[model samples]
Target: MTDQRAPLIQRGIVDLMIAADRLRFQIEAALRPMGINLTQMSLLNHFSWQPDRAQSITELTDVMAINQPGVTKAIAALADRGLVEKIDDAEDARVKRVKITPAGLEALGQARQAAWPPVEAAFGSLDDEELAAFTSHLVKMKASLAIS
Candidate 1:
């Protein structure tokens, strides 16, 4: 004889997957009109956030938790679209650094402005304390999961 009643256990990865899917859907919807996908937007955002830092495809792979080939493909596409430019690394000519162009910056700014209002509205019902607590918990979870 065995006990048949047991509660289903949900892991952090399951929650993360759901959240990531939702975020991707929202971002894709926001970026569709601009002819950009989530991957391109993410790269652009990274460049905007760290203007001084020179990021390579490999670096982007690690930061984005994606593969090198995918990042390379995205970079090539963005370059073709004139949204990003590849510059030779000063110290290592063999290495290429990615930088966002003026057009890319403008696009990113517009996308951020347009997307933030809706996202803010969704979360705005929460009080400041609740928001802070949620943020803190999320940060801890991310740290625990070793998600950069």
Candidate 2:
């Protein structure tokens, strides 16, 4: 007899990957009109949420799950667009801290407003119970994958 477990495992992995890709694509599309990609939007959101805290490139790399060069490039792009400003850390001149500019805040607000409709529509089909359960499952999954 064939092993039933193999197909189940393969299907689960493929489905998960496909679902993630589709969700990412949808989010990217929603952000494209704002002239910002999903990665930059995420960084902007981080800044918006913590306006007072200046984030270092290493901190952002860990938060964004990207490499040093990627974080540096994204920050450089945002700085070039006048959305963010970089300042040298007082304690450690070798480190640079990034802060969002007023223009960045405005753009982030606009992007969030524009992106909400699609997200609302996606969740509109779920009832309150289903939404809660889905959110709980996502939280658990994220925690499970958290780096120790």
Candidate 3:
């Protein structure tokens, strides 16, 4: 029974991965013309969602699921572009926080506008019922995977 289930499990994982990769590829293509990558947009999105419009490096790592070095590098790049600021946390001098600037929000808005139409169209192609099922499944999977 275990041997029989192995191929089924592997195929299921492969199919899921392929679907996800394909969707990501489409999204990347949509965003490429706007000169923004998903990671950068994600950072801006994170700041938009944040109550204070800032996040400590430690909090970024935990919330973004990225390592310190990666977070630091991205934050530095954003800062260099005048999209974000790296500041010492008021509550903790040792903790560095990333804050999105108005420019960042504007850039993020542009990027989102460029990306969302095609991305939404891809989903729009799906039937409403199918989309709902897929969305619910994704939500369940994210929770299962501890994504947030």
Kindly report which residue stretches of model 2 are placed more than 4 angstroms away from their true locations once superposed.
Answer: 1-12
* CA-lDDT, candidates in order: 0.81, 0.87, 0.82
Query: How well does candidate 2 score on lDDT at residue 76?
Result: 94
Candidate 2 residue lDDT tens string, 1-148: 2787988968977987887787778878998888887788889999998887888999998887888998898899999999999999999989999999999999899888877876787779999999999899889888988864
After superposition on all CA atoms, how large is the RMSD of candidate 3?
2.6
User: For this target, which candidate reaches the highest lDDT against the unseen true structure?
Assistant: 2
TM-score of each: 0.79, 0.86, 0.83
Off by over 4 Å in 3: 1-9
Steric overlap count per candidate: 0, 0, 0
In model 3, what lDDT does residue 85 have?
Answer: 83
Cα lDDT tens digits, model 1, 1-148, are 2434322224555766786788668867877887788888888898988666768887889888878988999899889988889989989889999888888888888888766765776578899999999889889877887845
Ten-residue segment with the worst summed lDDT in candidate 1? Answer: 1-10
Q: Model 3, 1-148: lDDT tens per residue? A: 4797899979988998987787777777888886667778888888987525677887888988988898888788788888888887888888887899988888898888877876787688789899999899989888888955
